[model samples]
Target: MSSDTYDFIVVGGGTAGLVVASRLSEDPRQRVLVLEAGADTNSDPRIKIPASWVSLQGTDMDWGFRTEPQPLLGGRSIGVSQGKILGGSSSINAQVFVPCNPAVIDHWNSSLGNSGWDWETFSPYYAKAYTTPPVDDSLAVKLGIDGWTGHSSAHGPLPTSFPGNPSHPIRKAWADTFRANGHYQTQDPFIDGAQGSFSCLATVDPVTKERTSAATAYYHPNRARKNLHVLTNATVERIRFDGEDQKRATGVVYNYNGEHREVTCSKEVILAAGALQSPKVLELSGVGNTKFLGKHGIEPVIDLPGVGENLFDHLVNTTSFGAVDDLETLDPLILDPSVGEQAAKDFAERQTGLLTSMGVYTYAYLPIMEHISGEGQKRLKKLLQDNPPAPGDGPDQIRAQAYYKIAERGLLDPKQASGAYLSFIGPWGGPPEPGSRTLTLCVMLSQPLSRGSVHIGSKDISAAPIVDPNYLSNPLDLDLFAEHMLYIETLARSAPLTDLLKHPIIHRDPASDLTDLETARKWVQKNSNSMWHLGGSCAMLPRQMNGVVDSTLKVYGTTNLRIVDSSAIPLMSTANLQATVFAFAERAADLIKEAWSQK
Candidate 1:
């Protein structure tokens, strides 16, 4: 092999890409190379401070991709923020570290035809990705985390902690309100997929109060290893194959510093460019539908039609209410510039106050039927009965039918959480009053029935792919999301939680009054936005089922090529995708190690 050749070439030095590179390079004999299109922003404070996450979007650190106008969202073009920095979305995200509903993972194996991917087998990888912060006795009781015993793991590369002031009234109020409603969590969510309210974790180092991104946790620590090499500002155009008939990825063609370059890999090529861009890479390399490739003037290598299909993302709608005057919300941070100085001082001095938090401390995963009324329940049942899964035996239809069956079962089951709700301690879509604070309730559809696609618009790799999430396109999705939105009103009006808000319920947006199902539906159509938890563009299942990759994360009809990112997740997780993405990469690294070790 030449000096430029390595054992493995990993594309997109993002969250999953870093994890795989770090793990694969553990053996001294193996040589690994990582190509990242974005610059290394790991040292930037905007990427380090937990509260600075929101500011990183639209800056140099973000990809700044926008979705096509959706008819359901009043024809609005939503901004899809992807991290273009070294850590990828993990560096730019809000840092909520939550797990997928275990039941959903079970579906990946039992229903999606991916063996050894069940919750029991995949759960261990979650433990391998992060070490949970310890909860003190007093804080545990206050946060309702006392019941969460004997579940957390103390070993992992990433550090996870509960962000914000532990004694913040919102934390106790949230837990008490859920308990009063008989919806308090029964077990730790990390260990069991229980549906209830609880305080969630963030990827923040407890000691340093800095963001624990994949770059900081995985890459930075292992970067000194001689076997590992990383190139930043290197944009991979496509995979370089051995030949048209062989279909083996031997190297990659990337552009760096205004010059195109090629580097060969002796072993394997891993694609971790994320859900939005991974499919673009595969399609550009001639692994997609021949018709689509030919349209872009690219010759075909493998005729895989599922390269960019089955796109899934969580859609969220937020409603903000006025908070009590005494409560400390993040509103002042934006409204008052002086508050920023104090926050900076407080963080520098003691690692406390607004700088240490993102003002989103509480979360709940609840079943739709449990929150809706009897009439609503009947209506939901009728909706499901009236519109069954798409009828067909073809690959795309089969995949859709399988997802519909699983979604239907969970939608009806009281034990399953169809909606993920969280409380943010500030106004979300509207401005706050001069003398008043705000509390925003975000209601998200955990499992969406609608599917979309991301495909290349031109042969040029620099051009962004066309993204259409097709959010709320399915009739059931609109109705189901409306039900969840209506429930948010109930939660806000409920006990202890209501105490945190002002009397008479002063809403940030008067139109957000979710009085009835119809009103809620109208509000959702206009207000809902992407949660940025995109996945499944390159799913893992049988090839006949519109699966780009198989159970082993290997692309079909191709050797030495695999996808180890959110793009390969068949079913989107229940809540935030960072934790799930971390676990998935951890498991993929093990799988890759096992595969090559045998050779």
Candidate 2:
């Protein structure tokens, strides 16, 4: 084989690309080349420890890309961080291990005609990619092993441990109050088709207490493979194609060491450049809508209309409250050892420590109740028949009434929270709304109805794309978010949590409390931002959807071109996209192996 050519040229040595390149290189007969846009992951300490991630933002290792001003989010530019290193964003993300919701999968399989993506079918791939941590009986009992990524706890590579910090009297009292208010503690949060409040674990090493990322899990152990060439500080411009047959993706043109070079792929070219860059590559390659291409002075190729559409992200609105008279701000014993040596000893001996804390210990999920399920429509109707809203009260008021009823049961404590944490929902797009207090309650609007596109900024491959997410263009999304905010308001005014808030005098701007609806709308417009979970710019779809790739993970217009990255998710899953992305790569590897065998 020539030095310039290989069996596969995998673009982007991050999570998905590295997984595919590693698995493919297992066969010495086939050569795999992984091109990365940033440096190697070896020197970054932040990449090694899970808790160290907060320090990595805007660093050289991160792409640190900023989005165009969002109209819904007060026209503020949101920050997006992607690892430019070998592991991709996985090298920098908080190692939260959550699963794709079953409802999300069913929507993909049943509605999108992607047959193999359903939960039952994709379960094996998830298990294949995951290396579970060791867990004691207590932790395992809390996070069930029945249907999760195999109970590898006994001898798994990853380490899973609960926080060892003994619950403070105030913390215990508050948690107890939560139960009295009606919110019950749950065992496992990831059980199939289930939602509940439970303590969770991060992806870390049991022995070292370090974060376990894809770069470490997949690439570091196999760095010596002769056929595997990993290049860093090199940016990909676009896939080169033969004009005679625009469908064929021949090779890629990239710049490394300040020089331009063309590399050919003997068999295939796989794109794992992620959600934001994948579509930009396609547009640069002339595979998107001709008009959009022509407007940018690029020649048209595949003319796929949906190449850069369907952008989705999550938004997080976080507020901290003084739930108890004693401050929970920072545990001196845990954060700084000058106060206590026992805290450090506990953290070192057992992986459980104060640093392992997820500020918000409990995360709850509440479905929009008014949209009654097949079983609850009549019950809702009957309840409404007995106590209907006043003649002119809108659906928001009706929903607010139901929200208050649920709040009475006490799952959420608004007052305990210093402010609202706006977290993005999943599926499509999201919306924004107005509220009060130093911290206002808000929804992530993870799933939004608005669609946006991504196109190349110029011919320079290393240059990032022009991204337009068009956030919060849907009214229904805004309404749902507003309903949840009101529910939180009710929760904040409830008993136990209210006591905590009274001492600290949590204040809100008077502007947020306007009686006129339009005035309140302005406040919401000035304060929304993204959760930074951007995806679906290069969606996987059937031929009918005019998608970029097929179920086999192969690029639609080219025989040897495949995409194994976040760009391939047809629709955003309700959970974080990282874990699901690993599963996608795991499954893509199997398909690639099978296709290779046929030849």
Candidate 3:
């Protein structure tokens, strides 16, 4: 029996996994092990250079899972790619690091009844994890002073900053455009207000111009510690239970170096696999929806019906226009050999240029509802009036109900769910034309009324999970998308945005007045895409609500087992999930530490 034993075994060496492992091993005596099914990509160039982010998708670094053909998305099978590298999605995702709406977190505590998990409760964790360069004195207030620990400094190691070299001069114009449209403008995106147009902060070092991923930020610094062991290319087959009762998790079975290996955990086994794969992992371990287990010919160890349900994410609809002038978009710099050579030389020599900026560093958290025309509002109001209660009593259906209620509230209040997320960055693939510059207006749905599911297609963990995001299944979500789409069309043609554009109407034809809702809906249907903000597949609701985990982040119907990733998120409450997720891991670590200390 060639095996190893540890104090804790964290499944999935991704963002949350690394955070938990590093924190737990800080005790010096605890032995922490991290099992990752992907290769360590610290040396990957695509990961370090901010501009090369788009190129990493669909490659070996991506999990490459596509949704079941969405009935609402023109029957299209959209890709819901997960990160398949050491840092996980953080290593592959765009470097946009932003804050979650405080109200949304408050909802999880007050409205959804998740105690000890609110804005005030978790603010300290966020402060403990986020660090910025050229430190702002006001950030001193963001450093957990809101009554949690009286007062503290921002001591966490993760660094977030603006573009190292510089941003395009147009950033001022972008800020002016938001202000012109009556939106609140901010110097820093992570603000107490949580709504407004602001210059975005990237999870990159200001000096090196490299992505500050979970591995780089949390794990690598602590790698020299002997208590923390990271096993790359290690696939956890299933968690082993202490007994046939399946009440307690004892260890895990994994395949490493072409051989099955077992590892015992003296204290606990936490599953930090992301939303997409975490539920599948539970199902494969016989701890999911009983009916699903029966259908898949797996013995049901626990009837936790919520393990792989409640999948949802922001559905982004993008429109790219031809800009009159070059805007430092990655297209030309990487697409053209001569320009790419210069970019490479500059990056290596000076750590600057097009490669440093991710092309887009500003995000407008717009209150799209207020900006919508009377006609659009009237149409949406009538539709909301007619929306039937989401049909099933199942957990997924209950989640759909909660999602709609919150989204409806957001329409009336920007502080609740942000109205929409807008960013500019694209000229993707090939340029639209020769010597043509590009400007992409990305409008993202902050609170989608859609619910989907993920289940194991095979007992094999290596096989892709059956993902059905069921996008736009709820007409209301589509209605919001349409409304925002039409609104952005107007913004693109407005004074500030249009004044800066070389060609206003090149890529888009806002010819339609959108007197009817269907006109806007048709346009959005043509251009909708996932924003890669996947979560809620394994929610943390009340047990009767089909929750896979509880507010304490402990798995329902099981002891010594927990899932501490986006999978446990009750809803997608943020735009970019990295900041929220890192903060979440910090909080979870405290909870685990408390529990272990009591033992």
Candidate 4:
């Protein structure tokens, strides 16, 4: 083999990319290479510290793709962040490790044509990807949480653990209120797809109390493999195809250090770029919709319409409440130098402090039916019964609604449905004054009936793609999200939680009055932002259904090319995407080896 050639080339050194690269190169015979556009995090304090997760956004570490003006959000162009660092969004995300609702996965395979993606089939991959810390009996008792495992330790690369210090006065208040309100049901997301609230874990190393990103656990440990190679600061220009049919992907052309370079693969080319960039690579490589390709002056190769369609993301609405009572948020840690220094010292010395926290220790995952008003529920059901698919959407999206019907039945009858995922943010996105206290609630409606697109607006590869998430486009989605926000308002005014906090600090003066449905609906539209769980752009299904990839994860008309990231998820999991993406890559790794071992 030549110096630049390999048996496999995996693009986008992100979470899934690293997983696939590491597993594929496990064999001494296979040569694998990874191309990443961003620099490695390299023990950067901003990235290592759990509390600094939000600070990484908009920095050089973030892809920072601003969405097209959402007409529904009063023409606001929301910033959709994709991690430009080694682990992709997993590196910058909140690090919560909740798996999707089991029924949601069942719905995917049953109705969405994704044949083998059920929970039972994928559960082992979850155990294979990461190991959790054992139940901290002391902290568990204080938090009133259980179901913790992984202390005996498994052999997975990534680590999952409760923060050495996850407790806050506000955190306890929120949990107590949820329980007091009868909303806190014991549905352990990891053990079962329990629909109600529970304590969750984070993707952080237990000993070091540092963020255990995909790069740290999956890629760095395997860096010394002779068959594996990683190329950082290299951006994939386009996939290189073989012969006139363009059926087989030979390698990729990428820009590294101001020069365009090509690496050939004897076996296959895999694209593990996250949702936003993977589809752009497809469009740039001439594998997207016919009209979109022609408009960008790129000759169409496969004309697969699903390459950049079916875009879905979780939109979050956050509100900060000010408390004048005996609340101790992280405000002083950021506003006062002495407190910040003390936190840094504690983490460095004992690996224990507020800095070790993933910001959110407790969260709720309940059926949307639990939150919606009776009138709203009837209206939502009627809207879905109407079953209106968006204009220009393909068959896979129509199928997604069918799966929703399953969940709808589960909700209406004694079955399953999509969830409204709400996580409490202690200390808020930004700190308040030195002595002021603030509590933030991140209200999210995870699965949406709304569908959107991601397409390259310019022929230039570096230009940002047109990402129209089309948030709140579906009347049902808008209505459901609004109901969830109202439910949060209810939580805000509930028993123990209400007693802890004073009042919310929304844009409106009369934040006290969120009772009116229309007023609350408008508040959600203006304040909602991407939860950063963007996916479902290049769906996996049959070709006739306008699927970009098949059940095997191979592109419809191409050979030796596969998408192994968030982009290939046919239906967006109704939870944080990091754990789901990790398991998917673990499964994809096996699929890749199976495909080639026979060859």
Which whole-number lDDT from 0 to 100 does residue 597 have in model 3? Answer: 91
Residue-wise C-alpha lDDT for candidate 3, range 1-599, written one tens digit per residue: 12489989999988889888889989988889999999988678889988888889899999988989887878889887688999899899887877777777877876665888788787777667878555445442232111111222455778877663343544555666666766644334344535666666788887788888889988999999988899999988888775655478989998998999989998899999899888887888889878888888888888887777888788777667767665555557645789888988898898977788676666666655543567646665677778755588875566657667776676665334444555565563235555666777777888777788888897876788888988888777777777777676677787666765665376633433344558878866765777778888778788756777888888877778988888888867658778888888888888889989967
Q: Candidate order by lDDT, highest to lowest?
A: 1, 4, 3, 2
Q: Encode model 4's per-residue lDDT on 1-599: one tens digit a residue.
A: 34799999999999999999999988989999999999997478988898888788899999988999999988999988888988888788888887777777776688777888788898678778988676546665456463323123445899888664655555456557667756564534565554566666788888888998889998889899888889899999999886666588988999999999998989889999889889999999989889988988998888798888888898887666766456555666777888889999999898887688766776776665442557756766676776655444556655555646654665554234345555444454445655666666667776787878898888898898889989988777777677677676666677776776765533223452467568778877877788878888888866656788887899888878999999899777767888889989999999999998888
Question: Which candidate number has the best lDDT?
Answer: 1
Off by over 4 Å in 4: 147-155, 164-188, 243-246, 369-377, 390-407, 410-417, 423-434, 503-513
Q: Give the root-mean-square deviation of each candidate in angstroms.
A: 1.5, 8.7, 4.1, 2.9
Candidate 1 lDDT by residue in tens digits, 496-562: 8999999999888889988998999999988888889999999998987989998999998888899
lDDT of each: 0.89, 0.59, 0.75, 0.77
Q: Where in model 2 is the C-alpha error above 4 Å?
A: 138-194, 243-246, 325-361, 369-443, 489-524
- Residue 327 lDDT, candidate 1, scale 0-100: 86
Query: In each prediction, how many residue pairs overlap at the backbone (N, C-alpha, C within less than 3 A)?
Result: 0, 23, 1, 2
Q: List the residue pairs that clash in candidate 4.
A: 410-415, 410-416
| Candidate 3 C-alpha error for residue 595, in Å | 0.7
Tell me how far the alpha carbon of residue 433 in candidate 4 is from the true structure, in angstroms, after superposition: 4.7
What value does the lDDT take at residue 347 in candidate 2?
55
In candidate 3, residue 6 scores what lDDT? 90
Q: Is 2 or 3 the stronger prediction by TM-score? A: 3
**TM-score result, candidate 2:** 0.78
lDDT of 4 at 466: 89
